[model samples]
Target: MSVNRATMQGAFDLCELFQMGGVPSIIAGGAARDIYFGVRPKDIDVIICGISMETASEILAGAGIASTPFHIYNGAASDRLVGGFKLVGTDIDVCLYDCTDVSEAIDAFDFNLNQFVISGIHHGIDGAHVRFVGEIHWSTLAAVRKDFTPARHDKMQAKWLDLSWRRATGEAVEVPVGGLDGPY
Candidate 1:
């Protein structure tokens, strides 16, 4: 499916906010992967340099946008609901500069496909210049007939639970091959 025009701009607007704030930002996770597949992202994930909720709100507030502080993750720089951004369940993770870099954050992703970022915020740039970052892995282009990777690393479990839930709701996943590397 082609991406919706509104969603595309919404992603840009959300990510660009950090760029404008002098914090280099990258759009990561499922949205970045799904963009390559021409699918509308289920959610948007923007990883940015250290920024507090107060700072984010201040930025958005200047743009006449409204935001709500929602502490979804502990220790995160900010977890908020940004208004005027047309994304469903949008999340922005702020990594402190001293703690983590963008590449490190990408490496910590659960799956290979997820370990990518689209950085529109170029450093030492004058205007709002943007560009895609990282190379798409051969694995991401390949089908998932191989092993199942963890949907989350902290839990260290594959998507079995999520698939099972889908199954219960009559959306069972079918394995293309007879075997898979990890538990499915």
Candidate 2:
């Protein structure tokens, strides 16, 4: 599979926008996994580090990006998600973490595949852009190439099965993993 141009462009543009707003962020989770596999991401997940949800909301709103609060309900406990925004035909979900660096946020991911991130975005007036950054976890590369998911949580087993099937058949399959949001 080849990289999806539109999805990647949207990710890059979002990173640039956040950078311009002086808020450091990175694209991670399923979106990064898809990008590494040369597949178009279903949606882009952004991790905004070292900021409160209110501050992040202000930055997003200032950039003309309207976002809605996202929450994951797990029984009696409801997990509040940062925000969900749409940009360039792509759904971008933002997660606010109280961390100083993108790596810290990436470390909170449950699986290695979702741990990969796109960072170090550089925008230039001369059109010399260098958007790709961050190292791909070895386990993530192995899982995707070998069509297997490393043992982590028992709940994620089905997700691996669906991923394998998707890879073999080239079909998009949605497997609900009990509202498993990335990195809180």
> Against the true structure, whose TM-score is highest?
2
Candidate 2, poorest ten consecutive residues by summed lDDT: 175-184
| lDDT digits (tens) for residues 1-184 of candidate 1 | 3334444455567567767767656666565544433344555556654556566566766876554544433332321222122223334333322222556555444445454454432321122222223344423232222333343342323322332232244221221101132110
> Which has the greatest lDDT?
2
lDDT of 2: 0.51
Cα RMSDs of all predictions? 12.1, 10.4
Instruction: Give the least accurate 10-residue stretch of model 1, judged by summed lDDT.
Output: 175-184
**Residue-wise C-alpha lDDT for candidate 2, range 18-135, written one tens digit per residue:** 7677777776777665544444566777777766767776777787776776533331112123344443334666776556777666655544546555543353212222122324
Collision pairs in model 1: none
User: What's the TM-score of each model vs. the native?
Assistant: 0.51, 0.59
Residue 60's lDDT within candidate 1 is 61
Candidate 1 runs further than 4 Å off: 1-3, 73-100, 119-184
